[model samples]
Target: GAGVSQSPSNKVTEKGKDVELRCDPISGHTALYWYRQSLGQGLEFLIYFQGNSAPDKSGLPSDRFSAERTGGSVSTLTIQRTQQEDSAVYLCASSLGPGVVYGYTFGSGTRLTVV
Candidate 1:
């Protein structure tokens, strides 16, 4: 893809249901990231995958949130036992590398609503 792509732009899931959000990053980008944004809130880093390096999972709010990148091109964010608090816009971004200098390309995001 020319830019980051995310699936299911909108999702409404019942509480306790699990959901998977996908992301296809731009070609040649080695740095991919997942973020969660509450209404009118700043992005909260969720996870980061850079090349073959170990992913940084520290940002995940809990074990129920996880993500992975495959073949260095696509990524998926999975949320288990969804709660109302989990309702937010999940954004995916990619860059040439990690750092502010590289900037980032973000997807429109998947708006998740857990009721």
Candidate 2:
């Protein structure tokens, strides 16, 4: 893909249901990231994957949230037992590499609503 791509642009799930968000990063990019944005809140970093290094999962709000990157290309973010508070737009981005220099190319995002 020319830029980052995310699947199922919108999702509406019942509370307690599980949902998975997928991201396909640009080819040759070495860094990938996941973020969340609430209605009026700033973007929240959820995870980061750089090259072959271990993924950074520190920002995940709880154990119910998890993510993984396969072949350093595609990534998936899964949320279990969805709660109303979890409703937000899930964004994915990829950069040429880590640091501020490369910046990031972001996906439009997957909007999840827990009803």
Per-model TM values vs. the true structure: 0.95, 0.95
Residue 29 lDDT in candidate 1 = 92
lDDT of 2 by residue, 1-115 (tens): 8778999899999999999999999999989999999998999999999964545888999999988888989988999999999999999999988886958999999999999
What TM-score does prediction 2 earn? Answer: 0.95
As a TM-score, model 1 comes out at 0.95
Model 1 lDDT, full chain set = 0.91
- lDDT of model 2 at position 46: 90
The regions of model 2 sitting more than 4 angstroms off are none
Query: In model 1, what lDDT does residue 12 have?
Result: 99
Per residue, candidate 1 scores C-alpha lDDT tens digits across 55-90 of: 688899999988888898889899999999999999
Instruction: Please give the RMSD of candidate 1 to the true structure.
Output: 1.2
